[model samples]
Target: MHDMQKELSTDELMGRFLNQLKDEDQLTEKQKRIMEAAVKLFSEKGFHAASTSEIAKEAGVAEGTIFRHFKTKKDILISLVAPIMLRFASPLLLKDVRKLMGSDLPLDDLLKQLYQNRLQIIEKNWSQIRLIIQEMQFHEELRGAVVENLFGVGRKLAEAFVSSKIQSGEIRNFPPLTVTRALVSMMVGYVFFKFVIFPDEGMNLDDEQEIEIMVDIILNGIRNKE
Candidate 1:
């Protein structure tokens, strides 16, 4: 929304997104405090091991105050997940994606934009995302809920986007799903390698510049030349 993709760090974007949503939701100061506390503790300690009292202590609120906003600890987890879904996993944001697929934009340009947008989202919510991923391994119901509510429609939209690119001869001919996976891997893999595997803080390249290189490699490797 701010067009500060290359300028802002992931933490800044996350703080901005959090503040924006808090204002929209009209969450009380105490509620914000509790939510922040829950994020910290849940990420540090497993949710099963983190108690309401510990979260309350971290937030500097009475334990009962958390119940004022959330019915249970699980509800707290859902609240943390909502911002991610609204930003990246929602179908409303698919309009821009659909336009990109249908437009005459260069594949490199479209993919560079897509990669930056995704990295911004992932970086902004890495903590909550990591927590959710960890918990989903043990919680079938939580995984099912995420799949049904977010991934189901999101996957279809992604497939449709990939199909559009294929029909236009922009990329190689392959199964839409395979194309989706390849594109996604390039995007996600860069983040994993750059931030997690290598942790290069001294890199001078911004997200757009780095992702453009990745897009070039992908296109050069995959383009169908008749």
Candidate 2:
């Protein structure tokens, strides 16, 4: 699907992301405002450059109000990640992914659909994700949270799928975790290459074609050739 096809306003996007949080109902309206403001500011300016006071000003809340909900600026940053992890780890998303894994489509087609599903999610949450990536390098705690909370569960699912594929003679007999790692690395690398290296300006890459090539590369390397 095209990006504009499902484009949501920044308010709408943050609202939806917040809805995914388990503690969403527990959050006050002021807290939601703080989060929305923080996301916009963090995405526009790097995390280090964005301050809690700035977030409070943008949110139209007192600076002390922000601390009433969050312990520190870093706590606010970690809080943003909670909704993201919840979205992917939610039962509905897990069911969709499991369905894809169990489909009888050709490996290439399956991979393409998987790529689209994941890319859609990334596109919807790009603001928080970009900010998280930018700040993760400097914060050991954020790095650990992302790796353990964001990716840990998904990695288990991927490894299990790889194992099943190997057992069915649909893929190479490499270690399931290794195969999962390679596939995940390719997808993550493609995202970084698209956004960081050659973003919208000066580059005109077709996402569909790139996904096809990625699936081809994966199949050529991992498909059972016997």
Candidate 3:
């Protein structure tokens, strides 16, 4: 267990980061390929629509190889999506969350930077995000796995951040939980509207403009004050 001093590319760094979750399941190299193929196929073709043979073809493995590793297709789905969900639980992302919680940047500037960072991350990982949302609607196990493994730290961090802002009088005087929920609601709404609801190729705001406008609305309001 020694640390290396060499620099790693983003993909290599992510691969090493994910390998940390190998503590839970000892997957062979082939098993890892099968899980990745399963995720891609599941995202493209729905879980029920994708067959083991198709997964095998995508994974470049023999038909029986998938079955050898996974008892059933659902087993493969669980294995594939669980780790991807745990990407949220990564300490690397937690470091950013901690910074967000503790940073003394101006509230508007902090929020804009946070939203831009999140937008980039979500854009990069939209495939996995889509798979998680689609499957978790029906697969309680996948949903439960995310809550059990990831939400604890995230919820606490969010609560602490909100509480601190409230105490500092930077935020309006509202219940901490309510304020936290409002922040998440505003963020989710911004992302959905920008990316999905009202996405117009010709009339899109640049990331900085989009994030700043949204952060302004979140910090101030649309209502006219007397």
Candidate 4:
């Protein structure tokens, strides 16, 4: 079976693969400091622009200490990939969807809860998300992982929900994939427009208002029903 097809829990896989070093005392304090510094610097500056010396300075370690932990500056960039996948993508792909699906709340209420949960997650991990988005352009591995683990899982979940709703005649009959894409696109566009494109102006709607407006728009098209 393919690695992707394996049923290993993300936490278990991560612990087995990543924590081994930490458990064996192979990961030193200096390495931990370097990783933290690298995450911050790489998030703020693109990988091409970030420097080992700058990372070392931020970590309060000698420049050579970086090489002791990482073979090259590029290794530091690569290191960000696993953590980004484990910390950010894994929760959305593996955990949040399960909780959302199991909830007894109504669809609209559930969506609001899920939206808030996602928003909080994004706000807390904004730097890491920014780093992944920035680095994805240059790294094929990062791009593939985002496509396979993040967007792919999300698309699948959305399709499942849309299909169920359509089967029950709760929603208009449309291609499940198309509906999923449209819904996801709308939410992503709203987030990008608010945070990335017009951040200086601030969010136009508060959380509750935003949820209400978004839910209304999604459930009912822009066309007047009358």
lDDT of each: 0.72, 0.78, 0.71, 0.70
Q: Listing every candidate in turn, what is its Cα RMSD in Å to the true structure after a full C-alpha superposition?
A: 9.9, 9.6, 9.4, 6.6
**How many residue pairs collide in each prediction?**
0, 0, 0, 0
List candidate 4 stretches off by more than 4 Å: 1-29, 88-93, 203-205, 224-226
The most accurate candidate by lDDT is 2
TM-score ranking, high to low: 1, 4, 2, 3
Q: What is residue 145's positional error in candidate 3, in angstroms? A: 2.2
Alpha-carbon shift of residue 39 in model 3 (angstroms): 2.6
Q: Model 3, 93-119: lDDT tens per residue?
A: 568867875788988888777777777
Candidate 2's TM-score reads 0.77
TM-score of 3: 0.76
The true-structure Cα RMSD of candidate 3 reads 9.4
Per residue, candidate 4 scores C-alpha lDDT tens digits across 46-125 of 78678889999999999888877776776665555565566545654458766785666677777777677777767676
C-alpha lDDT of residue 71 in model 2: 65
TM accuracy, model 4 = 0.78
In model 4, the clashing pairs are none
Please list the residue runs of candidate 3 whose C-alpha ends up more than 4 Å from where it truly belongs after superposition: 1-33, 68-71, 194-205, 224-226
lDDT of 2 by residue, 108-213 (tens): 8998999988987887898888887887787665666567655787988898889999999999899998899889999898888887777874157777888898
Worst 10 residues of 3 by lDDT: 1-10
What local lDDT score does residue 193 receive in model 2, on the 0 to 100 scale?
83
In candidate 4, position 145 carries an lDDT of 59
